[model samples]
Target: MRRTATGLLVVMAGLFGLARWMEPAYPAWSFVRAFAEAAMVGGMADWFAVTALFRHPLGIPIPHTAIIPNNKDRIAETLARFLRENFLTPIIVSRRMQRIDVAGAVGRFLADPVPGGRLRKGAGRLLADALEALDPERLGTMVRGGLVAQLRRLEVAPLIGQALAAAMTDGRHRPIIDTMILWADRTLDANQVLIRESVAKRAGSLLRWTGLDERLANAILDALHKLLAEMAADPDHPVRAKSEEGMAELAHRLQHDPELRAKVEHAKEEILDNPAISLWWQGVWEQARAGLLRAARSPDTAVAGFIGDGLRQLGDTLQREPRLAHTINRFARRATVGITTGYGDQIVRVVSETVRRWDTETLTGRLEQTVGRDLQYIRINGTLVGGLVGLLIHTFDTLI
Candidate 1:
């Protein structure tokens, strides 16, 4: 189109110039000469206006010509301002967004199983890549440095103590306590011979001090065994009850007493400071991290299947529940708006900076190559329209 327009303009200019030269020789072609001259003038004026936007006409450096190259910065700034004012303004954006009914469109798209499957697959791949790229060591370090440090600085002992007190009061740990006691009893019985030998060795000095006979030591050992057996047999024994009571009292004090709270905090600090404890924690972290990485990397793993199944179920739920879908869409839209609102200026700056960094000549050349053909139509239209108008004017003048 641009080529055709330019060619027409060039042809008209030549014809007009030729007619001017031939007018004296052929006086009968005066109407044709006048029309050609008017056409040429109009073509040239339009051509100048259009060419001035991009470059100097015929390599002549006219002021305000080559506007794009000379004032590209100002142009870009104006373009950006225009975009912000006309398209990106909050009210305009909101109105456009509301008219689109984006939530409904999205919901309809997701309702289809095929599209939903594709979405899920894409999301899964992204999630897997993201998870795989995450360096557990870095994550652990961050958690340790930021979260753990913050947690350590916080006074969490009182909260923990209160939770413990509640558990104890509700007899949540009774079964554990009973199991431990039973295990202890069985262990003591298993080591009775060793205990008896150690007792005998220690009793020799005691016997000398008290002037007690060997029979007395034997009787005392038998009595201690009997007591252990009785305590083991009766779960509701005074000893067990007293132990439970002591534990409950300790928990209560830890929760309610300031001194106990301080003591708990001190213990927490000690644990956190200990090298052995840190090593233990690190070892546990490494094991858990290795397990997670191994599972995530294996496509055939149950963990992957479980995750996929859960996602499928969630997708199904979203499809079934319009309200949930609406909520999710609304939340996502708001989140998008929030991000754009907060970072839009930065985004614009980045774009502007990148554009500014480009070689102007190269950019202009590329743009011309892409769109120059279309601009030619304007010149062609100018020539045709100008010729018609000139012909009409000449006819009207002849009649007058």
Candidate 2:
């Protein structure tokens, strides 16, 4: 830039000198003098104007000179304000987010097997690291606290009552009762010898002496068998109905009986208070953590495979479901707008603070590097235009 400016000045000076030397020999030298003289003045004026933007020209302290360095703070503030108000506004951010197809983009990314695999691997590693970092005692405490809170909130007796009621609905408990009765019948049939011995021991001396205890035991066994058979075969048997009525009464008591509920609740508390349950829970956690760590380390991990498959499935669904995509867009827009709106002031401060940290020398040097060449062109234009205008004036003066 300096070289170009110097070259133009040299050309102007040469023309002026030659014109002055040739003025006596040729009257047309006057036009050359006018154009060159005017051009030289124009170039100098442009050079000064351009120089004054960055610094005081010739080291002279002039009003509004060295504009960039003097008003750097104001410029920084204005720039920061402009960006905050216009570029980073909630409306602008929300609109931009609305235009972006985040779900579709995510779906496309997840659908790619290579990237999906990488993501799965990365998640596995992170999970493994997290598990490894957990302190056993701390984790135990946390789990205990959570479990205690949940237990405190739960009414165990009512829950159990409801579950029992549900299980008894639609004759569901009948099959269980039938199976129990069958087992009892088989037991009575198999234990005949024991039954006969008991019967003989309980019999009078005469029956024992005549060995009629066996016959009696046989009769009792036959009666028991017949009763079981009848209960099993006859759906409307009196015993079956009585048993069902008893079960219904129990279910209703469990659901509504305050005393029964209290007893149940006390039993539950006792079970939980037992050290064995705590030990069991701890064991469960340890086993789960160990398995999770192993799965995370191994390539054949169910969690990672599930994650990859789920991502692909989600992506496919989103691609097919326009309403789902729109829902995602709405959520994304809301989040973006919320973040921008909440942090707008901070963002503005960041810009201003960054600018404020820059020293004058560094800022000026950078600005010069970026736009110095362009400013030189302005100087060249000024010089050429000034010269043309000067020539026109000179011509008009001569003609007049």
Candidate 3:
């Protein structure tokens, strides 16, 4: 459209110039003819210059004409090279970024309540979307494959034994032993009737063998009950001491003995290899996922409050601590530098490759649409400015 309009203007000016030169006129008419002729010359000159950029004027095969289409590859290469040299240079980027004062800008934004709220809301929405997009089954499989399976393969028995040994050495297991003893005592005391019944049954068998009566059986039952009562009452009894010694010996063996450790490891492997273990793990994961999903879905949930509090705390810390802020900024800058340094070529390649893939005609059309209006002004200005220059030259030539 622009090219067509420019061509029409040029043609109109040419015709007007021819009309002026062919017909001689009076002084006023001559002055008008001079201005019109000069305007035509100015318009024609500008038209050729503009046309020569994209194509040869009037289809004439001129050098450097249609420069863009003929040398598009060179143009792309030059653009890429220019970006790599100037815009992507570390010093240039750093200076430009520093001038922007990104940290100060971020701080100011975070300090503003409305902007901060909006930022928080945006972050929350992003997080929610991410969470929603996550597949629970896939996540479970990854956890099982990556973490649980790895843990199952690890030798945990040695560590567990070492910890047990430490606990025993520190007398941490003593309370457990005391509690067991107390529980056993209470159980025995509560089952006195069962104890008596068992004693009576044993006594009867002995009487049948010794040819005694029910009185002897009754005496034997009473003696057995007394013995049990004494055992329960006495904390320092031989039974209690033996039980403690047995537990201590077991702990020592578990820690010092390789055989014991191997046995424990074998048992652990057996448990882990069991289908029940996997089912249990899957159940627990499902419950946890369900709980989290429920909490996230609820608007008035503690999870939301906790997240809000965490964000607020982070914002506060970033604002209050200058060293922290500097560290974050320095880290961000270093990361940016690393990416640009390490993958700069790749980035340029991607841009060039993408541009090369685009249909040239479509690309040209889109570019024109975006900046064509502004470029039209150039033609208009050229016409106006050229006419003025032409008039000045004509006047000067006549005067000389």
Candidate 4:
């Protein structure tokens, strides 16, 4: 294309030479001479304009020539600024993200099974690689830290109070109370001989001689059994009422009593500090990690199948529940907007710095490769248009 454009310029120059030489003998040659003159001027001017974008024309150091190479850093900054202000802005990104169904897209991606179950296999392998790449000790430490942080943030007293309150409200506490009572009865039955021996020891010598101690022991046992039966059969028994009231008071104190709440908090800290608990938790973590690693590595494992089923179920839920999808999409949009707002400046800086680091030759080559052809056409257009205008001017001059 460049050669073609340059060739046209040569042809116009030839015409101009021919016309200028013939104009002395023929008046009509003057019009051709004028057209060719204008054509050469327009073509040369456009050629300079085009060449200046990539380099200095004819290798001369001219002001404003080699526009792109000389102004590369400025161009980079401008480009980065443009992106930050236009495309990377929070408002623009948020608005654009509003129309995107992020959760729906994720649902479709997860739910749709690929040929030969390759997607699941590929995902498993990817996860396996990621897990293998992690340093086990560091990962364990991070996991432990995260768990501790969450635990520290949790208000244990209020949570326990709420749970206890909920259990009572739903009448679930009755079964627990009944189980405790049954256990107590079994314990009492198991220790009956010990109780009888204690009664015998406490009895006087006269009572022991008449076998009155045995009778007293039996009578005490019978009365205790009857009382237990009464308590078990009567829902409105005083003992049961007292127990319920004590439980209610404890629940209330767990939530509202500062002293009790502090005690609970202290107990929580003690539990966290316990070596037994720590060892148990460490064992659990190791087991869990090992299990996850196995699952990730083996696509056909039960754990892997369970994970796949869970993901499919989640995808189905997302697809079926528009409200959930919308909520997820909203969260995604907000998260994206936050990232854009936070890192946009750094992103722009990185872009500008990358461009600034490029050598002039590379930068010039890239820009020329992108838009050089269109610039050649500009030269061609200028030559033809200039020639036509010159012809019209010549005709007007003759008529006037």
Write one digit per residue (lDDT tens) for candidate 4, span 249-296: 888999999999899888888887778976787788888888877876
After superposition on all CA atoms, what RMSD does each candidate show versus the true structure?
10.8, 10.4, 12.3, 7.1
Error of model 4, residue 148, in angstroms: 2.1
Tens digit per residue, CA lDDT, model 1, 154-213: 887667767777777787867767777777767766776776566567776867567564
Q: After superposition, how far is residue 52 of candidate 2 from its true place, in Å?
A: 1.3
Per-candidate TM-score against the hidden true structure: 0.54, 0.53, 0.53, 0.65
Runs of candidate 3 with Cα error greater than 4 angstroms are: 1-25, 55-63, 100-304
Quote the RMSD, in angstroms, for model 3: 12.3
Better of 2 and 4 by lDDT: 4
Q: Global CA lDDT of candidate 2, please?
A: 0.84
Candidate topping TM-score: 4
lDDT of prediction 1: 0.69
| Candidate 3 residue lDDT tens string, 1-400 | 4775477567647656665766574343444455556666666676676666666778889988866666666666777788888878777766665545455556554444353354545555565566669897888878777876687777776676667678767877666766675676567667767765665576666676675645564565566556555655675677657866887677677767889878988888888788998888899889876665654454234224664456456666777888887877777777777778888888777767666666656555655577667766666666666666666766776679
Give lDDT: candidate 4, residue 127.
85
Output the lDDT of residue 316, model 3: 69
Q: What lDDT would candidate 4 get against the real structure?
A: 0.88
Per-candidate clashes, comma-separated: 1, 0, 0, 0
